[model samples]
Target: MQLIKPFRKLVVSVLLIGSSIFSVSSAIAQESSVESRILVNVDVIYPVNYLKEEFKKISSNPTQADVVQIGGQLNFSTIPDIQAIRFSRSFIYDPFANDYYNNRNVGGSDFNYSDQASTSNPFLSATFTERKGNPPLTLSFNSSGSNPPALAYNGTSCKDNDGCVLMHYGYSEEITSRNALTPSLFKTILKLRDNNGNLVSMINAMATPIVTSSSGGVTQYLIAYHEQSDPANNGVLMGVWTEIPVASGISSNSMLLQKQLKDIVQNQSQSPRLSYSNSSNSKITISNTRYFLSSTQIPLDQLSRTSLPPTDSRFMPLPNADGTISPGETTKPVIIAQTQSAKKAMTWVINNKVDVNGETYVQARYDSKTNPYSGDTSVDQTLSLLCIRKSPELTSNPIPEIAKGTTYTNSWSGGEVFAIPEVVGNSLLSEQNADNKCQEEGQKRYSLSGFRMAEFHDGIQPSGFGFYAKSTDPNLSISNVRYWVKINDQNANPWSK
Candidate 1:
């Protein structure tokens, strides 16, 4: 089989942890002329220890078909101008290659190339594990060496503690629109999220706006950084190209993207319905969670991309241990950037009682503490993730005011507690709590009414407000306001939002 060969020599700098910065020594000339386009080179840096372990199996037992593959998907939807994409080349780079060729028995082959069929999915592929064929891109590693070896990219010393390998792959895509002398957008932005799904801001997380090379109607841009600390497992890298000469660095505060979520119902049904007293101050802007969702709707509304936040690890491209954005590097700013296990406080107010198809359902109001009454009710309280169970002891009664410093209370009949401004019912008030079930079912007969993440301020009211059957049960007729705590701690309950 004929091999689609990669360039004989391509210069790649090592800007990973404990590695020195290297310059590109040369560039391969384009074989043919092409239309103006953008070249996005995505390099996933794997730790030396991680790779050593990953390849141990294949190296120990060599086989003809055994190969190691590592790849990730790229997202570019944030860039509005670019509308189409085309696949480019994929290759592996070994910083130790030159040393191996120079009669120094330090490691294995420094450079290797292979061909993979391009697919519509934007996954960049790299496969190298055990050698099999002539001109093979795979090889076995020899860990027998005295002193740690020096990398070809500027003689940077490498050790297992902080060394890294680069699997560089890229795509060439056409921009939907642009100007005459300059490209539509120059700088690219990357947002990082931690494993906990919270946005993390670091000075080095954003790619440096550097135009590494421009040749043959194709412009290449490079983004180099260490693997994020506590990175989201499914994080993605995105960017756009521009003709602008200089790129700038972004502020740490700007790293965490901001979003606003409005509380509005997309679907509402009466008889078993949701009613909001007013819409005043019914929106919330947050920067903590990876994304937010619109609260109090028939079907919850998604308000933002579910992108994971970038790692807090210093962006390693700059090469300094201190890892700060250099004044010179700022010239080309690439655009930048189930279970309820515990008890959580919940307040349920009686909105109304409805009989639906011979089954009795209860509608309760849930809202944030600071929101004003939107419609006709005067309910005031904050909502939380909760499970509700029918109380065999109490009838429907309102506990209007709980003191500010009070922890939680289940007692009722003190006074007439008004209904909450935001009321939710319909499908949320189910005959069976199939969507959410109580984790403490063994002890208490509590069942789940609804479940929601903390990012959503409003959701279906607590489960205890209504009964599923209207048979001879006396509690169904005079069901009153009751509060049941739902577990909301993520650490304790994986289902906690």
Candidate 2:
């Protein structure tokens, strides 16, 4: 009996240990199945090998190119994951990055990028190429110009020797470096052409030594071609470029997105409208009634652009901070200096094309005057204890419908700005006539997509929507316009590849 009892206890212990092992194994399998990874629609392709051979040839002696493909893409989606390629210059940039790699003949607006060095600006691909220096090597904005200017012997010529193709690149000065390499690497082949538009030379730009985020990197490559007397007729056009593949991340911090939103609102609450008054100019010719916004107000004995509400010139009474109401108080009030009759308020389109993020896009307004209040205007109101501190904003916004592209993932409409005053006053005799104190006034500027109007009234409509352009034709006018935006999004990165 004693022997049998001991054997039974051993069997129970073994069974309990087996149960724990199975639980752990199941958990591990579940976690593995759901891990996140990055997925891209296109893969990156580099031109390093071809470029290396071509560079060898150039060093032997400069020469013009034959037709070559600088950028490449799979005719169809390739399997597995997208490839990212990186391209590095033969040498590192100077501490100030002011060498010929970043400077030389480029000047004026083109050199504006040089000043961005402090911010570690990105090197963007040039939209177009130009010639510079004394007789600026015969160049034209229109590459196809029939009369090519004569090239200067002392002008911008082919580098190293006469056999050089002119190439343009966007550069970022080293203000600060995140060295987000891999993702920043790119590859492409240079296909050269002559003034008459014939293929002249071709070379592939190759890869560089692997660089980590710790050590900043450069974006560059080189080519040589015969200097054309009329380079415009013989100038080279840019070809395909591809981004090198890199391990994907969710990208930066989500807090940055939130901060961008707050900035949009803050700008709207204080931006101004545009106005023009030539000592002369009158009404319209057509039956059309042009609309405009006017912070303009009547200068009554006490009312000014700085007027407060109730007895002030701009807006009505604001509920007291304590949430108490006074006798004979009305929910709304009339101000003597208002730019528009509250009843005339209609809709507005407020923008001229401006840069947002890194591109230029315009906004599409939706909320009309009558429907303005329907929008969720939770924009914060700044309160100032002392005038020196930025005061709380007293503003409202009309809802907007922004333009979007297919596959657009999200939309953020900061809405249109509306400026008004606040007042806390009452009808009394001693404290009497309820002295209306003027609170600091402010303006709201409309901005979405990172840009707001630099000047106001760019799009002010008393009745219709606002846009940056204008046309006399009624059928194709703002009234006839309609806007729609579409969107798409994918997980930027996943735990599992």
Candidate 3:
């Protein structure tokens, strides 16, 4: 198993699509709600020789793509272990509905236009050819016009003299998976398209390890892509672009096959409804959706980019120093300082997306709305606390310690952003609450993945399911517990590659 260095850094350059430059402020953020941003910093690494052979096919013509699709699928055959699986997906900005500014363009909105930078463009491969070395590139969200944002390949843009796409191309896991079993790294089947709609579908794909086990085993992986979009067209649903290939050499009666079929049926039956809305527009709820073929071609201009509903306005209550709830006490999770970690969590939380150890660690919060745990709205309040200290680290790329004899694995795919709840404190909450929370919230996001408590807890104790440590500072009780979703200053990039 060969692994290339996963992440590479790149500088950003804004794209100038037209001569008429509209001097608009970058983008205003909403403090009272959960805001999401695009994560351009995370990168994918592939062998130079591998990319070169693929590049030779479509280097001559850059703008003749017939159809372009932006998502990939997981190959279950690569993983040998026999166990359960969970798949889910999320989006920061939808390119098929409308643009972020509510302005519909001739071809597509800025979000859709920016997405082309990664796919349906040959600039990234051309940059590699020019530099002769794989220097990194950065894709930023510049919501200025109907053009894609400019990406610098190692701080340099491609000259017009060189024939290439206007922007670079990169891929990521629009749909990701997690499993408790220590299965082998998954093989992804990716489809690469260049300017003019040429296709170079990729098989046996590998990606960066976002989370690893205590033994240095990768727990989760981020499948990279050149471009991505929610499956839709002209305000109509086209369905998700995904596939699951049966691994070769596995027997028909193998547990892996049985498990795969079971998971699909179980998830399909419990799929939830997702509602999208703007200020005065009625909510557009999408339910009972289907998956699109991996080889299908989707047009860029007709692709939709709609605004996501603002994060839940309500806040969760904070526990006292003794880890007990207070009555009528609803202090939202606070962000005392604009630390990198705080920005990561708040920025990506709105989309229910994360880099695991790279961007932010986002876990689904339990459902306190539908079936209240406390059975009393007052006590069943959700709490959002931002831990300032790193000790007993709240987030790690390595999997957290699990309970003795209990096995767990997790996978992330794409779904709508639902509340990510952490079940801590005493038995006032049952273990079942945590399980139901994942189902309830996952469903609301239009997903039905299994829930594992150890994903968030540092360690479980007979006393409760949270992390507590001794601190020297006495002034750090309720004040140390910070809130983020309600703060007005916090905002994240709405689109990422």
Candidate 4:
């Protein structure tokens, strides 16, 4: 029993040692495999022989010469695990080829056909030729289902000169299932790079909702057209488009594809008009007569021309030649003529005893009649004249002080003026009574004041008044007193009794 127990223990020890050795060997093998894969991916990104072949193919005359020059650089460190790289190239037709060559004028001048031909270059191809390089050049690999499996190449041209580089044409591929590398799944990558093999930028991809992860790498080719300096040497024009093709597994392919797509979208041709819409509104008519130019009231001098109608003969009458009225002779029809000035017209009406509304009437014709004209017996006529001439001046005149202690004021220096006084006496007063009761009201210890009337002259005269007052009593205090006037010719009867 003892011997058996020792033998069993020995067997167990050997088995444990052997298992440990096997485990170490397996781990080493796995590490070596990973390293081999990394090296392969690195070589694919910098394949010297493949690049040379690509150059040769691009430069070939009739067979495969659409590519012009491949520019930019390839970077593999962006995605270290996947071996990502980015590249770009330009494409143009070979002008030196016998069948496809033609010297044509583009933008009023003839440029070598082999020179970089781009849309903005203002150069037109004499003959449209088939493209040689694969459009939307793609790289494929296997990777996690989430990672995209394809990458694409993008093309561009210089804006200023053919020799310069500019990105123009680009496209993106739809990411599909892990195993599928369909044409639609390819995309053109656009990237910026310096002379050295260093990436400057990666343009965004064009299509959206890329099903695959942004993992694929990118490759760039500079399409260059070689033109002879001498004009007579048959001018052999050639171009080359080169790119480093990665042969690593799916991860490397995914990295390159992502980079290429980004380049194509961000650096390629952009739409000139991003968006547009109609902008318009309903029409409006404005005129000086209909609307004022500014809130600031204008003086008479600044006013535009105003139109006045001719006076009616019935509204105005002139003195007869004879001293007495002729028997059976109807009163001479009053004749009124249009006047340029409002002051002149008012004077004529007052002095001539115009039969306004079939009754003789006159208001204060001048400054002398401010006390009320004596000859005009017709109250209606007098009131009519006062309404036309006196009230306007009263409302328009600037406020004047009534007395040292009183808040109300009056202006007697004016032409014709009138006002409505707020009598403190309880009884209401007629227009005639109010005029004569001024003294009575004054004697009663009640304040008698005149309020200025709005201005009334012709030819665009302003018609408004400004009044201000201050009092301790809230009810008696006048916060604001403004006056405005408009002609009421329909109700006016200057000669009515």
* Model 4 local distance difference test score: 0.18
Clashes of each: 31, 52, 59, 47
List the candidates ranked by TM-score, beginning with the highest.
Answer: 1, 3, 2, 4
Worst 10 residues of 4 by lDDT: 1-10
Model 2 per-residue lDDT at 228: 10
Predicted structure with the largest lDDT when compared to the true one: 1
Against the true structure, whose TM-score is highest? 1
Question: How well does candidate 3 match the true structure in TM-score terms?
Answer: 0.24
Report lDDT (Cα) of residue 167, candidate 1. 33
lDDT of 1 by residue, 1-497 (tens): 01111112222221111212222222221121123443333333334344344334334322111112322232222221112222223222222221222223223232222222122321112222222232222222222332221122232212244343333323333322111111211122222222223332211122212121122222212222222211231122222111221112322321111110011101111101011011011111111111111111211111001111212121112222112222112121111110111212233333345454454444333334211112211112222223333332323322223211122222221211112112232112221221232221212232222222111112222222222211222232224443222223221121121
Q: In model 2, where is the ten-residue run with the lowest total lDDT? A: 1-10
Model 2 segments beyond 4 Å from truth? 1-69, 72-187, 195-199, 204-456, 459-497
State every prediction's TM-score relative to the real structure.
0.24, 0.20, 0.24, 0.12
Cα lDDT for residue 398, model 1? 28
What is the per-residue lDDT of model 3 for residues 1-497, given as tens digits with 9 covering 90 to 100? 11122111111212224322111111211111111111221112222233334646666333222112222222222221211111111222222222212222212211222211211221111011111132112111222323323222231212222111222122222211222121112222334454444566543322111211111122111111111111221111111111121111222233332343232112221111111111111222222222211111211111111101101111111111011112111111111111111112121111122332333333322222321111212222233322222222322222333212142112221111223433122111223333344443444343334322222222232221222222222222232131222111222111100
Instruction: Name the lDDT value of residue 384 in candidate 3.
Output: 33
Give the residue spans of candidate 4 off by over 4 A. Answer: 1-317, 320-322, 340-480, 483-497
lDDT for every model?
Answer: 0.23, 0.20, 0.22, 0.18
RMSD (CA, Å), candidate 1 to true, equals 24.7
lDDT of 1 at 266: 14
Which structure is stronger by TM-score: 1 or 2?
1
Residues 458-482 of candidate 4 have per-residue lDDT tens digits of: 1122221111221112112112211
